[model samples]
Target: MMKESLCEVNNLGLRYHRGESAILQGLSLSLFKGEIVGIRGENGAGKSSLLKAIAGLLPYQEGEIRMPKEVRKGLSYLPQDLSLYDSLTALENLIFYGKIQGIPGRLLKTRGNWLLEELGLSQKSREKLSALSGGMKRRVHLASALMLRPSILLLDEPTVGCDEESYHRIRDLLLKMKQQGTGMLLISHGRGELEDLADRILTLEQGKLREKCISSD
Candidate 1:
């Protein structure tokens, strides 16, 4: 029997402003459960835009996006831009996002602490985001995204600016999530990382989607 797709995008099109040429045009793809789908392309190849559309962060002008309603309920997105509160600590940031995501109060506290410890931020849990380095901020942002235990994860340049240790931690965590049957849409420019982690690689060029098979080492 064939595996059911967690996500499907067909003839998707989007433009930032009216009459502007579509940033993403006729893009189509399917992502299955327990798979890490990587989107790779040049700087302006609409990789980020495609992710935004799938994540419901951007409105598309055309086409269908199909997903299990339950999976859609569990979707979590981490954008390339950092959006943490400058005055809040790493743990506080996680708590905020968790609460907003409807995580129970008791579970939020417990999960926040656990995530901070796991991400190696326990020592600086009280330090304000303003005091953290760029890499640290990125880690905090990623931690917030993981706090909800999302079944479908959409990550845009998740490892960008991360230190080597932090990068490995994030990479390993993603692998573990995939093993647990989480569907992922990963956008990255790093060929090495994509080659190592993605189950299927999709390239967007001139508004077209192409799949590239990658060997798993």
Candidate 2:
């Protein structure tokens, strides 16, 4: 069966400043429905830059990102840096994000509560984000990203700083999302995590990308 293309990056190019080294050059990739694509690279290899460009956070100097208008409405991006507000409670943060997404107040409340419970933050729903541990904060971030039940997720190290149980919960959630046909572009330093979750993995180096062989051992 042919896979449906959710997003396409064609010959993308980016640089922080003119005359400086290019961060990404002539990179092309496609994400398909229900697929998990893993990106691996050393520091400064522009892994995060690529995701940022795709998410419309960073503007690429060359090439283009193509997606259907409807798909754009369902896209979600989770950066490596925490994007949540420290002063807001977990539920409040979700409501804030959900509202921005235009979710109705009644529906947003229901959705926020559901996500907090699913990510194991139900007990801490009213706790301020700053009062939570790193793992808890990460979970809340995930919950906020999930508020819209996004069809495409650009996740940058989604499990970083997570406790063992929280890590497993997230892994299971990703699998479930995949089963539900959510396409994901995931970046992780752990090779085993990529091998287990990604249908295929791509390595980024020298501002380019190449398909990598997965070890069976």
Candidate 3:
């Protein structure tokens, strides 16, 4: 049986400004439920642009991005910056995002604690983002992203600063999400990470997307 495609991008194109060379062109891909699609590219290859377009953060100049009706409301974006409020504690940060995602106070508290513990940040839960190490902050940011139980997770350089334990924890979490019928589109610089986690790999180069060969397990 074929799994449903949670995300579809057909002939997608994007540019920095009018008449400028396109950063991405004729890009097409689909993210099916329980699947992880890994994307690789050189700097300024439009990987980020592609994610932003699917996330509706950037306006595409051509083509379409289609999400399943059921998934339309359940998508999450984790950009390279891992945005978090510098002044807020890890727990406070998750709670803030949970509220933004419409999670009730009680549920937010429960899920937030679970995520922090799962990601190895429970002990630092009360530490402000400014005080946490880069890896710890990244983990906190990820905890916030998962707090809402999103159906599709869009990741851009999500493992940049993670240590071995945090890296393993995140990989496990992503797999867990896949088992739960979530689709993922991941942009990563680490070839090994992509090989271990991705069901398929794609590369963006010269303003187009094409299949990239990855070593088998």
Best by lDDT: 2
TM-score of each: 0.93, 0.93, 0.94
Report the alpha-carbon TM-score of model 2 versus the true structure. 0.93
lDDT of 3 by residue, 94-127 (tens): 9999999999887988999999988878888888
Off by over 4 Å in 3: 213-217
List runs of model 2 lying over 4 Å from the truth: 213-217
Quote the lDDT for 54 in model 3.
91
Q: Estimate the overall C-alpha local distance difference test score of candidate 1.
A: 0.87
Q: How well does candidate 3 match the true structure in TM-score terms?
A: 0.94
lDDT of 1 by residue, 28-124 (tens): 8988888898889889888888888888888989998998899888899999999899988888899999999999998987998887777777898
Q: Between 1 and 3, whose TM-score is larger?
A: 3
The candidate, 2 or 3, that scores higher on TM-score is 3
Note each model's CA RMSD in angstroms. Answer: 1.7, 2.1, 1.7
